[model samples]
Target: MARQSLAERRRQLTEAAIRAMTRDGVARTTTRSIAAEAGVSLSVFHYCFDSKQVLLESVIEAITEHYITVVKEAIRPRATLRETVRAGFQAYWDHVHAHPGEHMLTYELTQYALRQPGFEHLARRQYELYADTYTGLIEELGRSMDFELRVPAPTLARYLAAMTDGLTLSLLVLGKDAVPASADILDTITEHVASLVGDEPARQSTEVAGGTA
Candidate 1:
């Protein structure tokens, strides 16, 4: 077999470190174990990452980039406004469901970063990227639909971003089965948002009629 290039080896080692951190938590994940998991020698791991902190930081950057790409892909331009919103939430749900270990690692890293100034900057920058992407989409939808949203597009975007994060944390703590019924909860919240923006008259009418009868 052809030998893997330096870039390929680094990527492999970084990914293996992420998986180890995810499964074992930061405190438990060791350089020896990460090297073992990657099927590489400890010297190879050190050559690629220099240190465990460097490996963990690389993992954070990789995971953040992957999430941003996924969210962008989910909000493709062809989708309708409602579909775009749904797609964003669905992407969050799918990502967490598909990679529970990664999600846990994200939380762990976030908490760890909060304690340090340098890591906090990266974490904040990642958050700003997420906010900017979602806010731009919301603004575009508002313009296209000519709706005067109760919350400005930027604010709404922040709200939705925070909501999704809170929901994900809830799922992490409460387990998948304990997550509130998706259809009902999302539908109700969406309706409430539409009502605030005076956007979904039909839904509001139906809700009013239901309440009356």
Candidate 2:
């Protein structure tokens, strides 16, 4: 068999860890289990990661990367700020529905990281990553719309991140039947973002009309 490159082995092991944790629950997951899931020997597990904590950190990195990709696709350039924000929320919720296991594993790993000694930083770092991702998106939205946000970008991003976390937990517990109602909750958030933009859309329209006259 061909030898795997260092990066490939690490990626394989990390994915295996995520699958094992999702299947067996975080507390019950072990290096033995993760190695088995990766189709490698126990020594390979150690070779790939210094410790289980390191492995978990890799998992967090993978989760954060995936989330950024998901959210970027959702919030990609749109014709209007309102539509852009709405698309982001809708795309995220759709992802939750499509990959419930992945989302569930993220939350599970977060709680696990918090309770584990020397691992609490992972949880904090995860939220920081989330805030940064959303903040960038909001800033991009403002640039695309030719408008400025009334609130600081970081502040608004953190607020939206908190709302998403809460809403995700609620949806996970409430199941598919509750998605529609949860959407209404998202609409409330959208309205909040809209309020921060004030009359930028109207002002832009007036500018266009004056320029064309």
Candidate 3:
């Protein structure tokens, strides 16, 4: 087999680490185990990731990207603005349902990070990544749909992030209890979020009609 580049090697190790962590709890997973999962030597794992923290961070990012990538695609301009927004949210919800274990591991990783000395930063970073991802998506939706925010972008982003986090955890914790209402819940949130946008063109049209009257 051809040799892997450093970036490729790190990507391989990161994917392997995610599989290991998702299968085994974060506390139980070790570099040796990740290397074995990736079919590489322990030394190769260390070479790619000098510390466990680095590997875990990569896993956090990879998992985030894994779900957000679907959302981004789902958010592509549909015929209706509300449809597009709802599609994005529904896509994320679908991911949570499909990969419940991965979502559960994210919460576990957060708790693990907070308990480990000097590793609290990882938990913070995890949340920050969520907020940042929302911020980007909100901006993208605004640009594509042509609307201004009723609130500050960051405020709206963080609010959405918090709402998603709550809903995801509720689903995971409540299990089947949340299943019946899950789609309806997501639709309600999508409507509330869509309503939070101030549509500039629509407002201008209404103002022009009033002026003519």
Q: What number of clashing residue pairs does each candidate have, in the order they appear?
A: 0, 0, 0
List lDDT for all candidates, in order. 0.70, 0.81, 0.89
Off by over 4 Å in 2: 197-199, 202-213
What's the TM-score of each model vs. the native?
Answer: 0.69, 0.86, 0.93
In terms of TM-score, how similar is model 2 to the real structure? 0.86
Model 1: per-residue lDDT, tens digit, 8-28?
988898888888888888778
| Candidate 1: clashing residue pairs, number | 0
**Which candidate number has the best lDDT?**
3
Can you write out model 3's per-residue Cα lDDT over 79-137, one digit (the tens) per residue? 77778888988899889988999999999999999999988999999999999999999
lDDT of 2 by residue, 172-198 (tens): 888888776866877887788777764
Candidate that would win on TM-score: 3
**Reference-based lDDT, residue 113, model 3:** 96
